[model samples]
Target: MRKYSIIFIFIAFVCHFVTGQNKQLLYDFSEIPQSLLINPGTETDFQWYSGVPILSGISLQAGSSGISVNDLFANDGIDFNDKVRDRLINGMSPKDDLSGTYQIELINIGYRGAETDNFYSFGIYNEGDAIGYWFKDYAKLGFEGNADNLNNRFNLSHLKTRGEILNVFHFGVTKEIDNKLTFGVRGKLYSGIIDFTSTKNKGYFVTTEGQNNLLSNTLSADLELKSSGIITLDHVIDGDSSAGDMIKRGFFGGDLGLGVDLGFTYHLNEQTLITGSLLDLGFLYHSTDVLSYTLKGNATVEGVEIILPDAINDPNTDFWQDLVDDVEGLVPFEENRKSYITFRPTKLYGSLRYNFGETVQSKGRLDCDCNLSGGKSNRTKYANGVGGQLYVINRPRGPQAALSAFYQRRFGNIMAVKTTYTIDKYSFSNVGLGLNLQAGPINMYFMADNLLAYRNIAASNYASFQLGINIISWGKN
Candidate 1:
């Protein structure tokens, strides 16, 4: 029974913190208001814009690496247990991981402020994100128990994971300084719907020589699980405890936190440009309905030491119960309802671009919207542009990076399109598309990523998409 502790730990970590999907398509495509979410400093030409309520911004992404659902459960006559074992040992490593994110806008709107060169944007969105690495040692232990691997030190430090579902209310301002550089800053208020995180775990399990029994087992553990908005929902769906109640808490009653985003766009020359941003520098304080489980003890067991004097063979003998009680006394576990702080996953994005082909002129500063503030003398519009983008997202397994080369084509000022090819941890065949269309005072846009995998999504390790509509009014100065 003592050996079953690992099962609980595995279930807790694996059940949450699946990696979030990459948002490479919408990061720097400044034609739409959603781009402001990634870089608050992004420039906009609209006099004022309001999203179409819930339909204004919608995005969904899902991805998992190292292994997929078909690899282990397919009906190809391969043994399921053997397939998993082989993949764990040969197909994956400690660095391989699974991750993705889900997000949707509840409200969004933006407009030029009273200041001539200032723009203001604000919105509310719900998001869920998670990240976790492959636990190699735990996998080996489950597949090939200690009965065969004697003297092997199975490590517990490999367990690392964090995840959260929350609502973000954000407000930002983008200001143009002179005509060549623009900077923006955004502040975010987070209301946690649910959260769980486990880090700094340390311990090991090993089998050694014993005096009476053939083998002795030892375990040293120092593990902690901090979670909020989970334990209190044990009876969420029963009686009057409905999902609406949870949502109410998520909107204003749950744990709260604050974060900020900083970004800038600079024009090196008339045809050259560069831009960058840092996001999510904040932490959440989980105090409401918080619960922490802790295990900190070391013990070695060498079988049941007590022997029954008479009726040892009786079915009602309490010898085994006594042994179990002794083991629990040595390694004690505790639970507390204490608060904790969890940091937001940070992200960085940067890009460099050059304009070529035919260029369009701008009438005034309000009309000089271009990638990285690059445009003609008044406002230059080019027929074609090429650039490269770099992105880094911090994860429990460490920081992961993606590099992309993109091409943009503009058909007058009414329509524009951008295409990108990216290489990241999940796949090398990632292709993304973005399109923006303006009809008078109305604007619409759509984006999709991982084009190749759409043919057979089940086999693909990544996929994401976004679309939105808004009404805009341009200034004529």
Candidate 2:
């Protein structure tokens, strides 16, 4: 009976081996930015003058300058989770029950200056940036009962994930010719870290003695006993056991790029103006560290014992060990992997506005404005979507009652923020309040999209944020 159980167990293992296929390598390039499309002009006091670049200005300005910093962080973290889920789920192992999450933290500081005299404007600046993401996953499986007769069956699995991080540094200059014709260029430095791991386990059992009793009890029992022998044959001999495997890898990379921003602002009338710009035309490169892993496992069989060789049992064996040992190893140790980071081409922006009742009284005059912008990016395998925003703002000549209203459309990983407001009897003229904050030569702000974490799917809720600073040549006063 034990012998038969062992045979059955071996067969099951072989079947498991032959039928299992590597999980499809789901590569989610969603993080890849959409084309740089026309985006609404939104800047904060600190950002507008600070001369720093922004990922998306309109949305960040909508959050109200100086809202709880915690809120800004919370919104961004939630949005990242939502955007990454679509890619994470596909890469998950079938045997793994995954559960783990990660969040990103960013900090940026820099200076920028721009010099503009009628026809030409040139600028220069430097910035420092840092960001991170973390997540964890736990995967497991278990089985109980006699290995030979298969009296009972049970299974359990779980996955937990943490976070990963990346950092960036940039220093460059931009140039613009005439208020009507503008050109710019910049250089960037990239650095980051990625660490991921997965683990799995399986358990089962078999029976041997019960078959002998069945054969003696009834005529039909003999036939059952014969079948039992074939099943319990392996289990009766090997006994209960457990096995598991895990792999982990870590790497880093860098990138660089050059872009141009051509914008034109024309006066429609004494109280109105229109402006637009084509932004972000450049390329970036990244280099990642070589990754390696060690694997080890143990399992118990019922009928016959199958032992792994000592070499295979050692978990200390590095993944690169084999390649290093190769007789004619030209590449001693894999140094790194290179990739081109292409800028999404959808960053184009345009806007129309009418300003009325200029500041004539001690309390500044009121200004009302509305604006919209949208963009999209396409990669080798997937296409990113687009979004737009509309907003209005009202401010007293002084710092007193500054109010605004906004509405935005965020699809996939994109986000928009629109606003509107009313003040004093004289309804202010066009005043779209899409501005970033600037302190001295530094500009910084935060943004988010896809507020909810939805995996393997695109939702209007996905969000993202950017806080940046740059130095530009301010037009001669």
lDDT digits (tens) for residues 342-440 of candidate 2: 331223344444433322111000111212211110001111211221222111111122222222222211222222231211112212322233333
**On a 0 to 1 TM-score scale, where does candidate 1 land against the true structure?**
0.88
lDDT of 1 by residue, 242-354 (tens): 77767876787999999999998887887778989898888899998797888778888888665556556665767678667766766678889999999898889898988
- CA lDDT, every model vs. true structure: 0.77, 0.25
Error of 2 at 146 (Å): 26
RMSD of each: 4.7, 21.3
Please report how far candidate 2 places residue 254 from its true position, in Å: 4.4
